[model samples]
Target chain A: MEIKTLSQDGVTIVTPVGRVDTSTAKAFEDGVMASISACNKIAIRFDEIDYMSSAGLRVVLMAGKKLSAIKGELVLINMPEKIFSVFKTSGFDKIIKICQTFEESKQFFN
Target chain B: MATAANILVLDDDEDTADLFRQKFRHQIMDGIYKFSFVIHPEEALDLLQQQVFDIFISDINVAGTDGISFIAKLRKDYSFMRSIVISAYGDINTLRAVMRGGAHDFVIKPIDFKDFGDTLAKTVRVVEQLRQAEATSRKLSAISDELGVSAQLQRSILPSNSLKKGNIEIWADSIPAAEVGGDFYDFFWLNNAKLGIVMADVSGKNVSAAMFALIAKTLIKSFSQIYTSPARCFETVNRTLYNENATSMFVTAIYGIVDMEKNELTYTNAGHLPIAAIRHNEDPRFLECEAGMALGICEDIVFTDSVHTFSPGEMILLYTDGVPEATDKNGNEYDYERFSEVLRQNAIMSPNLLTRALMESIREFTKGMSQSDDITTLCLKYRLRVTPNVN
Candidate 1:
């Protein structure tokens, strides 16, 4: 998995570019941690993530809880349908906030 | 090596700087070395922070900071660069200070042009060797990472957990050796009433064999959907494999189609191991078949098929040779006799427990020796719902 970070209006945008399965889940975690230390408002764009298994979900949960502890916010945007279903079925959608577009996600930080 | 080597020089004397330019005139003209000079030690320290240099050449004392203290700072931070200290004093204390400060070499002033040139050449040689070693180490790490990803990719291609469809509960498990193996097993619904099952073993080990196993599995599956008849499916798969067989590898496989409504299983064997089945209240026995040749050989060979009616509470087991052929520390195999005996004894158990019992028995027999081949097995139990009578 490749992680690209962009900072826009104090919100960190983390874009992961591949399957977030068991093998690459740790890399995803590290990428999130790198972006987490820099800013409080974070947005993870899942447009390029093709397949995500339970391992990826675990990382997402951990990121959510960590950000919550610091009174920071994390929003997921542009999720592909397959990965969205996995999130919904696993009940992660209820715990983590998700949005359909970048503008909507940015409003959470505002 | 073609790019000019960046060299940083710190000396207070102007003539010494001129001497270096004159001495390395040929190398500088050839574009082999690029030189940068700093008259003050503090200025050199600031320059060091801004850019990287291949070699550091400094005198014992400069305008503001001493060479030993500067060398100490450089060693604490950018220790990878080579440092050569030039000094007018040849005392043992000065030599010890230079060495303790992490200087690569110490040269006395009143420098000889020939000696200086030779020293510079040696320093550059050492720098090149270090770069080459670091590059090789990085390349090796990249290759290791790619292999790890390949292994994980291979694992993801396999079916996860057992599933119950129609009247059959199917469980398949495979434990690959330390290296990747060519064992493969798959089951999918051919229709609402029929389930297609496949178990195969390719000829070799490692990546190439695993790739061949994938191709063979895919071809057999696609062929089964098109042909329907077990024997005809094998024939078509064999012909396709023979045409595409570039590695000269062969695959031993057995394909079965189970019809839930008819309670019948029709199967074809391609030089694979005999499957064991336990009918209701009967001892486990190997299903009989005329063993045909493995696929990826000759294209003209025809395969034969066998049929068995599976009653409720009956179970059938399919496995690769890795099970019976598993070896002990004394090199004795578990053998087909013992394998069948274990199945016969545990025939009444559920498919999941039975498979786990067999795996545990094999582990006990092997005494934790490294596996030589992949051990794969599939246990399919035909379960019927028992209806309680209400009065």
Candidate 2:
């Protein structure tokens, strides 16, 4: 897995590529938590991510809970339909914010 | 600062072996780098036989048993040793042979000194990372085993033998999808007049959900002692869960209180699936008890109660979503239609047999496929009263 972070105006955009499974879930969690100390508005770009399992969902749920406690926002953008299905079935779509495009995610800032 | 571990270099060329030793020495003075140069492969084997080493680097074209053979022989006994082969003539076939012979890596002719050093460092780092991961997985497996035992203990907390409290005959079964499930069911007597029935499904699966289910059960039991009304019991549980839950996970539950003498059953549903009530010799119908959201999602949520009269031989069946949502191999759900049919077929059987037949039918429908969610079922059958003569 590859993770890159870009920060602007106190918002951090995290682009993750490749599959996130049990083997790499911890690294993904660490990368997301590292951004938590500095940025309140976080956006995750999952366009390149091909797959995710329950272990991956656990990490995202953990980050969501952390951000919610601080009254911050964690937005997911451009998720692949296959990966998005898992979230929707798990009811995470109701609890977390998801945007169809990066432009739509920027609306939260406005 | 921790010192890098010692590495052993075995090469036929004395000059090349010395260069390899000097390169690692310059990287860290505190770290010890060891070199053993042998003109033939036999001498290298002798050295390896005498002592243990963190790594072994060799030339593929060494005389008297080439590097590929040496690696194959060494791996038979010293399986844990990390081996790397360096070759002046970078033969793709030779590289593949050495790798298949258990060599960790291969360096080509005119080795870029910088790349060689970095590769060596990375090889060690990768090995250490693998070791740590193995250790962690072992710990997690042990903890999971312990949790499985605790889950069995939790199942034992349910009433094993039915309490002949009034005219209600209650039977419940909980089956976890994995080693531990988040589904729970319990029925306990509040007093001579009332009996409380609780069924809950916590979000997520495994240990997190199992822990929350236990806590929810405890809170409901403790609070129901003070307030016997079904609505009040759920209100107290929701408030307590909202304050105590740190993960923000929620639970769907139904709490019912049966007044045996008055033949009244009142219940509050908190985002749980609707319960089914089958009248004596009549078809099953879903109870009209829908009001509240899932618990632990918000504070000050209101839950309304629904009351119904329980006739003799009538039955009420409560279950987690796992039953209705169970899917077959083709992704078709078992659903409420099949569930009610199973109830109607086995409605005449004893409560225990009814639950067993329902589960058997689900198993048959799925064709022995693995259950994806926890399955929980609770049934209450009201019996007719026998007249007594007053002396």
Candidate 3:
């Protein structure tokens, strides 16, 4: 998995390419954790994700928990329909802030 | 000596033995160092082959061999053994040869007993560190071996691959991954008219997932008998799983009951995938229902039950995330498109053949890649629904 991190105006956007399963969840976690360390505001872009196992959701939950502890914000954006379906089925939508775009995340955060 | 490091020293000089023994006599008595001197290179090689020694201290002019070749052979064959070469004149060239030949350190001759002792002690400390690391690796391997044995025993206790009762014919199997996975399934006779079915996957893998799977399977089976509706049964089981979830792990499951008298299959989903249905002469489709939150995530979730008709020869397939999510070498998923294709082509297949076809399809798509998740599937075909008038 290749993770691209771009930070602008105090917000870091993480774009991960390809599957996020057991083999690559650690890399995803590391990228997200790195972003969290540098900035409190983060948005995960799931546009290129092919598939994500429950292990991938575990990482999301972990990121959310870590950010909550710091009184920081973690938002999910641009999830593919299939990926969004996963979060919806898992009821993660109930617990996390999800939006249609990074702009929407900024508006919601503001 | 309990903690003594056995040191093998090679030298032709007969007086070297007595000098080492005399100088380290107090240390030997205190059980810290034990020196074994060999006059010939062959004798040193013989002892090296037979036993594990802590250190090899050799003189460059030892009898029967050139020192560099012998030290190099020891370095190649027993690289972990600490070696120190003796440079007879504090010769820089001899010291360079010793280092190049892979000897760890060198001591000069006319030997400084105190300096020599200090060098040997340093090498001994390195040897002790290696010993501790070896012990830890051994312990870890032993623990993994135990996990392997426990997984085998659990496989023995898994529900049989196939079960038939009344009008329902079921074939269920949970394949074990390289590591122990948390997938489990079962189908049992609840009564003459009711049959219970379960398919579930606990989050993650390893011992905790295995244990959680076992606990959730047992509780679901027990609760199925106590509650008639799948919703009610899952409600109680969900609470138990939530209470028991210290690690915050969750279980995605579908627990259903087939009522032969009513010809209905009613089930409750807990964050599991949708059940696929293959009805004769009708388009294959996933059962329409709420996929719901997984058990142990929240304690207060109110589960809802969904109903599907079990018409004669209707087949239902339930699987874990391993299926469909199985990725190829190019990272493309064997997604629901393939899943439905398999179901459509094998709609008339017996529960057993349908399962084989599905697994073979997945295997074909993921021939060279390794799947980390457990692939579990349960197939049920209602051979004929029970009706008093038909009999």
Candidate 4:
């Protein structure tokens, strides 16, 4: 998976591409967790992701709990509908704010 | 006593042969053992090739040949025969060289005839035991290979269908701790809009458990197609398995049916781990289900189904005890507290990553420790379309 970190408007955006399964989940967790520690507000852009297993969901959960511990903010932006349903059904959408576009996620920072 | 063995002795001193004959005269007279002596290394080699001697005794300092080299050559050609080396040089280097040359043991020359018979007896017993152990090890390796092949076949039974149905994304995985394991997970579409998911753990390991797992999995899938509720599906499957469970083995399972059109999940637990639900914006929490008897334990036990409506963007997670019960080198279990904490931490990730992340946490906690059970996780994300559709 490709994780590109973009720091714009005080938010670190982690965009990972490809399928995140058992083999690559650790790297994905490290990338997002590192971004979470460095910045107060982090946004994971899911534009390039097409498939994610429970392993990937685990990284998100860990990042969410960490951000919560630090009173930091984490937002998921531009998640595909298929991916969004995964977040919604698992109750992740409630804990981590998700938006359809960067504009919508920008509102969380405001 | 009947003659028990034949011993070949290779010594350069011609008088040594007569010394052995006198020393073991009682044993020879009793027909307990027979001894033969060769004055030259070449003569010993020629005799060894022609006759099968039960044991070989060689003197290290022969007139024209080194005992160590002769033993090494004997090992190269007749390795199955055990040998003992005797030398006047009692130094550690000579002892090590003899051993490296494949001598089963070493003896000092100017041979104490009194101790010689006792030493030879012990060596023969040890060699017999070694032969038995090697044979057992070969048989064990063959059984292990067969188990490996069966494990591969078990993995092949997992559903290969694309996990996506409408907006629901389902993913499941199982990892065995042994050559074969009792844990199994599967997901199948009951109909166009209904999905069936199963995660089960049998009570034991190896081929017996794997065979039962196959039977349980097949029965569950077949009964699920005919039964309407998760409780009824498990009830019928349980009766079928209980009648055939002569070994008294049992299986803990969690079976769920997802109504995709209505975004509802109906599930039942058979003495399995509690299911977890992660709601958007809220921390992940374990869902409580009615405590029912595990399958194959009783024929008349009743199971109850719990229903939970999927609020858009909610996830349902099911796993075997291998997750919470994973232990560290210190023997402390990973436990539900750590599992919940891990789930809360990785709550924002996708389904695949979520499961993968839990496995990573378990792996980290249990580093260097051997797992005793199979680890398995099944996750379903319910996402109905924005536009309404009929069920």
Candidate 5:
């Protein structure tokens, strides 16, 4: 997995590409958690992400709960159709905010 | 921030080439795009040969030859290059031909700059993804290569071939359940008249288990040089291993010293399987020695010493649980009862032949079942007299 971060208007967008399985889950989790101490709003961009397994989901849930405890927002944006389906099937769509576009993601902070 | 796309444009028309170059010049200056231009297919090929490009854009109706043929030749040489065909007049047949010739995308004449830019960006992303996958695959291959070398090293620790010392003929065989296993066996002359034999099984399989097995085997040999008693040898080995090991791993072993001059065998069993002894023209029986706990478990544990009298033409066999617990296609174990029966039947053969026959029987029993653990066995046949023996 490759993780890249970008910040716009104080909201940090983390983009992770490639499969997130058992071998790469720790790196993904570390990347997400590392941003939590500094950023108030964390946006995970899944526009180019291909697939994610249970291990990846566990990290997302952990980051979500951690950010929530700090009274911060954990936003998921531009999820590709394949991964959006996984999110929906896993019931994560119900608990996490899903934005279809970057504009919508930016609006959530405003 | 948007990363610039490094685009290579190949077109024969000077006006079209300049226009293509000018269109990206502003973006290039703004750090959103980078461009390279070539006027001919050969020039494009030469540029590709010189340096790698993120994307290749070529005119379909170039002078001298068509873009389809160029793509075909390019695909033959560099299948990894991402190529796109541009034409003023789009032909369905030509489009199909260029696509079949390995063009990544087709653009109609009077290119819509927005669509073109998007296609170029997507192409660059595809190329980057491919490069990343290749790098990861190479790294994985390197790790696999290292694992193979470790497995080879593990194999080297086993006895090379069968050998005879004095009146005792020793033969051993080991088969790992995977690329590497935890089972090991070794034999060396303890003295001019005493030969030492050892067989052990580590708790797990693969590299970690093989490493521990090597450590245990080394400790046994090193300790045996100072302690003549089998129990004392195991005690020293256990203490050393217990201090060195951080993980909660253990090993079961059988160590014995065979005195060929007196025809006596003294051994200690460290939570290992029972040893079988068959005397000439007598029924085979388990050695029934007092067993001790596995090594590297607790430092205070003690191993008991056991002695047995060996007569001429007698045989002793030591093995790991992998042998008796081996299951067949029917899920039936080749248990101790069947193993003893096979050993008794093959008792008349030489130690080497008997070990081979035992392995053959196991292979037959587990016809379709994959070996689930490491199988190791050591045999020592005592020949009383040094005279010419009948085969």
Candidate 6:
């Protein structure tokens, strides 16, 4: 899996490509968590990822927890319908901030 | 190991002895070939018993014993030594028989000494490589033994008794993927004889995972005693785990209090799957709610408990992701739909039978294929209501 983390306008965008199941969860978690340490206002793009397991959700949960403790902001952006269903079923969509596109997430980050 | 090799020969003629002494004069001066030529087979056998040689070259005809019989004796007596047969070009049948009897190689009569020397050297090198490989295999087997002992120790700490308490029967069991796992289930007595149910899956495998699970179980058990509410106990345990953790390890758990006196269950599903239940003439379904974030991530998040009131002949199931995530030989996952179907079929059974029936269904679906994660299931059934007027 290719995980690209870029900072633009003080917002770190983590875009992970390919499947993020048990085998790649550790690498994906480390990339996102490192970006959190560097910047608090972060957005993750879920469009590139085709599949994710509970292991992937575990990383997002930890990142959410850590960001919450520091009073920081996190947003899930450009989420596909399939990926959003997972978040919705887990009840994470209710507690976490999400947007339909990066443009929508910009205001939420501010 | 790279030193010159000693050479032994058996032949009847003294000319054969002089040919070797003259031919290897330079090698002898360099301490390479230490040649000993014996005319009689009995004398050569006696010389072999007295000392060792790297190569034993034998001719087809000799005094007292034929060269073929001598080679056979040399093979039986000194199997470590590599024997080379000196045969005439026409003696292909004899050469083939000797090769079959484990001669390292056979050289034609009037042999080219340099080619024979190279063959002997290669044979010795192959033997050394075999010895090294054997030593490494022995060392690895010793490490495997230690892994087995660690798995045994982990199983000993888990409670396996299928016990019943206060009109409730429970069965909680965990089977690891490759001998050990990070999944755990526990049921303990809390305030006012209330049964506290716990089901958790930590993110890891083997020994480190087992150690983390021990810490999680102990902290939850201790914290439950200190706090009366399940939500409070989970919050304190999560705070403790997050503070003590040095690695990125985390646990998704469900901690609940099953109050037999009140016919109620107060639970906090911390980033775990919604609890599965079969209640009062209804189908099997998950008790959906906003499960909080998992433990050992951040310390400040407070968990909230959701309460469920049940009737007699109703059962609650708690499990890790291992059951649905397990794949068959064809790599098809035994998903939630299959799990619910099994629960629906065995809805009215006792806690023990319900758990057994679900496990049997899973086994049938997977068809003995090895799973990648740990499978843990806990069933709590209220055989009779604590207070009969809650309808």
Top lDDT model: 3
**Whole-model Cα lDDT of every candidate shown, in order:** 0.80, 0.77, 0.84, 0.78, 0.79, 0.79
lDDT of 4 by residue, B47-79 (tens): 888887768898877724476777887877875
In candidate 2, how many Å is residue B31 off? 47
lDDT tens per residue, model 1, B54-125: 788888766234667778778778755788888777877977977797888878878776887788878887
Q: DockQ for model 5?
A: 0.01
lDDT of 2 by residue, B28-69 (tens): 555534455666777767877887655677777773346687
Better of 2 and 6 by TM-score: 6
Per-residue CA lDDT of candidate 1, range A1-110, in tens?
A: 79999998889999999767445777998999889988888999999876664456656766786788799999999998867865654335755899998898877888
* Model 5, residue B75: C-alpha shift (Å): 1.6
Q: To one decimal, what is the Cα RMSD in angstroms of model 3 from the true structure?
A: 11.8
Q: For model 4 chain B, where is the 10-residue window of minimal lDDT?
A: B153-162
Which segments of candidate 4 are over 4 A away from where they belong? A1-110, B1-152, B388-391
Interface RMSD of each: 19.0, 5.8, 1.6, 12.0, 18.0, 3.4
Question: Model 6 clash pairs?
Answer: none
Q: Which candidate, 1 or 3, has the higher TM-score?
A: 3
TM-score of 4: 0.48
Clashing pairs in 3: none
User: Per-residue alpha-carbon lDDT of model 3 for A24-72, expressed as tens digits?
Assistant: 8889989989989988888999998888888788788878878888988
Per-residue accuracy of model 2 over A20-94 as CA lDDT, tens digit each:
754567788888989876887899888987666545676777788888879888999999886776566444576
Candidate 5 residue spans exceeding 4 A from truth: A1-110, B1-4, B26-32, B139-184, B187-195, B201-214, B225-232, B238-252, B257-274, B287-314, B320-339, B349-376, B381-391
Per-chain TM-score of chain A in candidate 6 equals 0.95
Better of 1 and 4 by lDDT: 1
TM-score of each: 0.56, 0.54, 0.67, 0.48, 0.56, 0.61
| Backbone clash count for every predicted candidate, in the order shown | 0, 0, 0, 53, 0, 0
Pairs that clash in candidate 2: none
Using TM-score as the yardstick, the better of models 1 and 2 is 1
TM-score of chain A of each: 0.96, 0.93, 0.96, 0.92, 0.94, 0.95
Candidate 5 chain B lowest-lDDT run of ten = B62-71
Order the candidate numbers by DockQ, best to worst.
3, 6, 2, 4, 5, 1
